[model samples]
Target: MKVLITGAAGFIGHALIKQLSATAEHVVGIDNINDYYDVELKHARLRDLEGIGNFTFIRADLVDAEVLNQIFATHRFDCVINLAAQAGVRYSLDNPKAYVQSNVVGFLNILEACRNFAVPKLLYASSSSVYGLSKDVPFSTRQSVDCPISLYAATKKANELMAHTYSHLYGIQTIGLRFFTVYGPWGRPDMAMFKFTKAILEGKPIDVYNHGQLSRDFTYIDDIISGVMRLLEKDGLEANSVFNIGHGSPVSLMDFIRAVESATGMTANCNYLPMQPGDVEQTWADTQGLFDAVGYTPSVKVAEGAARFVEWYRAYYKI
Candidate 1:
């Protein structure tokens, strides 16, 4: 099947492309390659995909409707996975416009293109942050996520609403996967796992936000991709569906730090700090909706995932 995957240079996007390539599926990937984090890392991800199976990469921004329209017309994809967005909670606090431009405008362009082009299905990225300050232990797709604490979370919620409207009106099969804290090799540098690992390696102090009192449902990259592939294969189920793609287990911040320390064989210098704005205390996903649809279950633990990431970091940086 022909597929169009946005944010090709991103962590999840890159991993998804690699998985899709192995199946000999023709994938046309696009990314603006903005300097949200490390541009070199993004380039490296693209370099890795070069000449891999039937994968094709296009350096373009999703906000540009003309470019997106042209690509949609050219590719005529069976599935369009819109993973492109400005992804960060704290970053959205300082730079709110960036979130609107990328997450809001970019996603609207995708929905419009899909509606006009008659694409069969759309698999877009949502976040567990949409749950906001909910007192719920494990977040379910059925829960009301109207009270978003951050602009980032608000935009993700908007994406869900937009996708649902299109699905209802135009008969497009839209699946919004509310991803929990996804971490593994090729993970984002801003994420806690990557930041802690880097700080430990550099002998710098790792900032423990909320005084290390937080818990996260850290799902492995392999499990995320597996669930995505299953959903892609089984498209056109419900008109509009939302699923929580996460490991049901929520790991504590201190335990997660200990796991990192064990993986790198170096202790992190913990510097406790107050919780930053737009940050939540905990996040745990109830992935029963995903399991019912795709029989998805996470297999990787934080310890093993951290070790694998450390190995990759050491090799990639020649440490």
Candidate 2:
């Protein structure tokens, strides 16, 4: 099958493309490669995919309708996976426009292209942050995600709404994967795992947000890819559906830090701080719905996942 995956250079996008390219007849990946973190890291990911024969990479922004439309016209992809977006909850507090432009307008463009091109399936990345300040223990797709604390979360919730509209109006099978705290090798530097690892290795203090009270369903990248692959290959899914793709087990901030320390063989100098704006106290996903549909569940525990990430970090940085 011919597949188009946006946000090709992103942590999840890059990893997804690597696995998808192995079986897909043709895989086209596109990324704006914005300087959200390190451009070199994004470039490094693209360089790693260079040996893949069936993979093609493009540097483009989702907001550029002309370029995106032309791409759809040329490729006429069998499936379109929209993973591109402005990430980070704290970043959104200061730069709300980035969230709207990339998450809202960009997604709208993607939906339009799918509608015009008659693409059968469009699976896009949503976020657990959409759950916001809800008292729900394990965030489920069935709960109301009406109250979003961050602009980023708000945008993601908006994406789901827009997707439902398109699915109803155009008969496109739109699947929104509400990703939990995804981490592992080639993970985004903005995330907690990467930041903690870097600081611990550098002998710098790591910021323990919410006074070390946060917890997350830190799903490994491999498990996330497996879930996405299942959704891609599975048949008879609802035309408009959303699933919480997560590990279903939440790891506390202190426990996560301990995992990092165990992996790196170094103690993390944690600087306790109050919760930052647009941050949540915890995130735990109820992945039963995803398992019922895809027969998949995230298996990597934080300890194992953190070890793998540290190994990669040490090897990649030669430290």
Per-prediction tally of clashes? 0, 0
Candidate 1: regions farther than 4 A off? none
Question: Over the stretch 237-281, how does candidate 1's per-residue lDDT look in tens digits?
Answer: 798999999999999999999999999999889999999998999
Best by lDDT: 2
Which ranges in model 2 have alpha carbons more than 4 Å from their true place? none
What TM-score would each prediction reach against the true structure? 0.99, 0.99
State the lDDT at 144 in candidate 2. 94
Quick one: RMSD of model 2? 0.6
Give the number of colliding residue pairs in candidate 2.
Answer: 0
Residue 168 error, candidate 2, Å = 0.2
lDDT per residue (tens digit) for residues 27-56 in model 2: 999999999899999999999999999998
